[model samples]
Target: MDTTHRKKNEQNNHPRKGITEFDSNRATLRGKNIFPPFYVKTTVPLQEALKNGEVRNNTHLLVIERNAQILALLTQQMNYHHVAQGEIAGEPWMVSL
Candidate 1:
């Protein structure tokens, strides 16, 4: 059988399936408790969180919510800046999407 067929069989027979090799490492990280939920905010500025020690440079995900809906997922490498007045400023960069 082809790889797709094999994967489908695995999904039918196993409780956990559709997990690609790349997801395996992320699973390990979760299993080992290596990563924790980073800062989550809506109106609260990320820079304020950083200055208040609620977030660090290694913070990967910024869960932003607006009007009870998730506005965006600010992933790692997302360009951002903190102003002198402790304001977070920046827009998500588009890469030929």
Candidate 2:
């Protein structure tokens, strides 16, 4: 994932009120989390939820990767916004909302 846009937004200290489709792909959902393995496997639908006002701050969504048995929870962080990058075995990726 490219941090160019994330960094730019971070510099301005702007909180994303809604997630556009363009930004949906950034979530990088794994296929196993979705209904079927052949599905889009993208968080775009979740982004649409935010865009459509279906969720609010402090709202968290959990995704379970059946294959890997990994649990991913996505939530927005009102403060301390920063993306910590790195991968650890058996550890799921965590991003601020």
Candidate 3:
């Protein structure tokens, strides 16, 4: 066999040699967004949210405070989205878990 053909055969015989090859036929969720990003547009007062049972005392929160203003996001919601974005103090921010 030619040198090139011999080298190709050797590579094909090794499991790790073509590890980087991407097989589109085997891609199950290709070009899909499994976890769409979550955005927080409107917010309610913490006290009111608690009163309405929107947030419980034991609920985990990702909190950010600036200029004496506080923004809290539910960690459980963020877990499903994998990413959460919001505007705080006129500045945009994102959190990824």
Residue-by-residue lDDT tens digits, candidate 3, 30-66: 5877999998899999999999999999999988775
- From the highest TM-score down, the ranking of the candidates is 3, 1, 2
Off by over 4 Å in 3: 1-29, 66-68
lDDT of 2 by residue, 57-91 (tens): 55865454543544344433222333322233435
User: In terms of TM-score, which candidate is stronger, 1 or 3?
Assistant: 3
* Residue 57 lDDT, candidate 2, scale 0-100: 52
Per-residue CA lDDT of candidate 1, range 17-94, in tens?
A: 555556555443434423333332334456776799876778776444333443333454233321111112343322
**lDDT for model 2:** 0.47
Clashing residue pairs in candidate 2 are 75-97
> What TM-score does candidate 3 get on C-alpha atoms?
0.63
Window of ten residues with lowest summed lDDT in model 1? 80-89
lDDT of 1: 0.46
- Stretch of 10 with least lDDT, candidate 2: 33-42
Q: Count the backbone clashes (under 3 Å) in each candidate.
A: 0, 1, 0
| Descending-lDDT candidate ranking | 3, 2, 1
